[model samples]
Target: MEPRKLLSSLFYFSLLSLLSANQQVVDSAHHHHHHRHRHLFDFRPSKLFVFGDSYADTGNIGRSLAGSWKQPYGITFPGKPAGRFSDGRVLTDYLVEIGTALLLIAAKFVGIKSPIPYKFRRVGGKHLRNGMNFAYGGTGVFQSTSPLPNMTTQIGFFQQLIKEGVYNSLELQQSSVALLVLSGNDYSAYISKNGSSQGFPSFITQVVNQLVLNLKMIQELGLKKIAVTTLQPLGCLPFSTAASSFQQCNGTQNALVNLHNLLLQQAVAKLNNETTNDHSTFVILDLNTAFMTVFTNKGDHLGSTRFENPLKPCCVGISNGDVCGSVDESGTKKYTVCENPEAAFFWDTVHPTQAGWRSVYSALQANLQQL
Candidate 1:
């Protein structure tokens, strides 16, 4: 089939699924009354340092080569692709809200109206004086599918900027927070490259080792507080569980994720013990717990976060052989979406919906209080 016709078919198929599902958004806030008072980070940070893959990538991906910069990806924000690998926002956008708000206030004081946020400016000059996003989709600690720079390379870019006097000692001293978002892209790459499943334990060890080194490198860069996300429920990702009809997450896969988190907990502890100022310097964002909270209390959320079948992804290939992004010779779309993206927890095969992230953020408030 022609690619155009294939896309057309997929589009129509998605439309039909949306009509039939008629899912509605689930707002869980009212029942819980879980609002909490503000903490230090609730105000603002001088800078926001980001690392990792598509989950946190803002605009580092090149326009011509990345699907993140293509149509249908950013349909929800800026009315066009703004370099995010999702329909709307990702981790960096949510985290940057705090600092960007501060930048806006500073602009107001300078008698400048509506100055561009630091994220929108180049990572040179005084712009780096505020903050800059360093994430690129399809990137990992090690090489992955895309040709973009990995996490280490991204940090290298930062180091180069510092060497060029883009940031001075005083500005680096003011830098308060750094956000690290790491998922299973490294593992995915290993699997895709025919790395054996039996070797996963060893591979995970290597990945964590690289991660620890990366964290140390960031601290050496003179940033103070660092918050790193634990791996989410990987087995529950739409792509992994699709084979089970999306009804059940793979227990074995989840067990591996548990091991990774356990190891990470120890690493964080060790890092704190070694550091001079140990006020929760390495904070772990427990995405595992947050994801489970939403999944278990689906109905508790306003409306029905309860999918008649939660494991199944709303948008997917017509057949098992294809995927959400697949298309045939015709100009028909192969993927389908739920009636409302807000109602669905998972967005595509791997990422979550904007609503899903909101839920995760709410769950993380307790840990965030210490920040």
Candidate 2:
């Protein structure tokens, strides 16, 4: 019953097919090629404005309370924690990284680095042209568990930067994309705050309503394109999957997620209808479906990704009392990392590994072209 012991038993999975994983990556590139030529003639954005919680946080959180600043968080990419909530790159990084390589691949994308965090805006002055990532760990559309800035406050920071003449409106309207990664921190806060399950439906409506307002604010701010991710399947996250020994998702929780995603789609459709002239005013990344695709196709590696333990986190606490980033008084780590992070899906309890995000992004490529 011990936590680490439970992991030791659960992780008796067969050795993952590294060749299959590599082939999956190659197939992902080929899918990108399917649309590569299409992007060549499109007006590719040079700047990316990111907002939301830890799912897209790129070092905006400080070292005091965030595990992102601790060891093993970013070991897969930068070789150390650079504040991304995962092992390495997140959805935000994949977007910028892939788009930056467009120039060479016939996609006509201009090279751009991950947007500088607002926390480093002063020292990272020149990089402001690449846009800003104002997202913080554990934040939500409304007030959430962590005391960091919520969506409103994050947007306020972006507005303040504009007021200081840190950005030009013309460039924003001409060649910038706003990525809003809202991955259900609101529901986490709701449950943690003892919100009644009976009122959950109404709360989901309220969350999506506020989210629509945020999208409008960003759109009215003159960004050329705005992309918002639908809520991923929260019920399939490791925390929810633990009850199934990482074999199946919690269907009860997933039903709620389906409701949330439906509402979000309706809201986005209305917004696009009202504001779209020649181009779409808003873009949906279909994250909910993408996540489902990965989960449902876990064992069928014929044409999809190969995640042997799709619901199991790669890193976990060695004991029930510890967490992925827990350390003892001696400053010794209390967690265990899998031998191959690239072969895992979920990184900790909630976020994905770099490979996990890569797979999810690969699955979402068709949806991404809308952006």
- What RMSD value applies to candidate 2? 7.8
Evaluate model 1: give its lDDT. Answer: 0.56
Which ten-residue region of model 2 has the weakest summed lDDT? Answer: 11-20
Candidate 1 structure, TM-score to reference: 0.77
Residue-pair clashes per candidate: 28, 0
Query: Tens-digit lDDT track for model 1 on 190-307?
Result: 6656788799788877877887888998888876556666777777766667677676776766777776666666676667667765322555556676666677665224443544
State the TM-score for model 2: 0.84
Stretches of candidate 2 off by over 4 Å are: 1-42, 100-108, 299-305, 366-371
Q: Model 2 clash pairs?
A: none
Query: What value does the lDDT take at residue 335 in candidate 2?
Result: 99
Candidate 2 structure lDDT: 0.69
Ten-residue stretch with the least lDDT total in model 1: 17-26
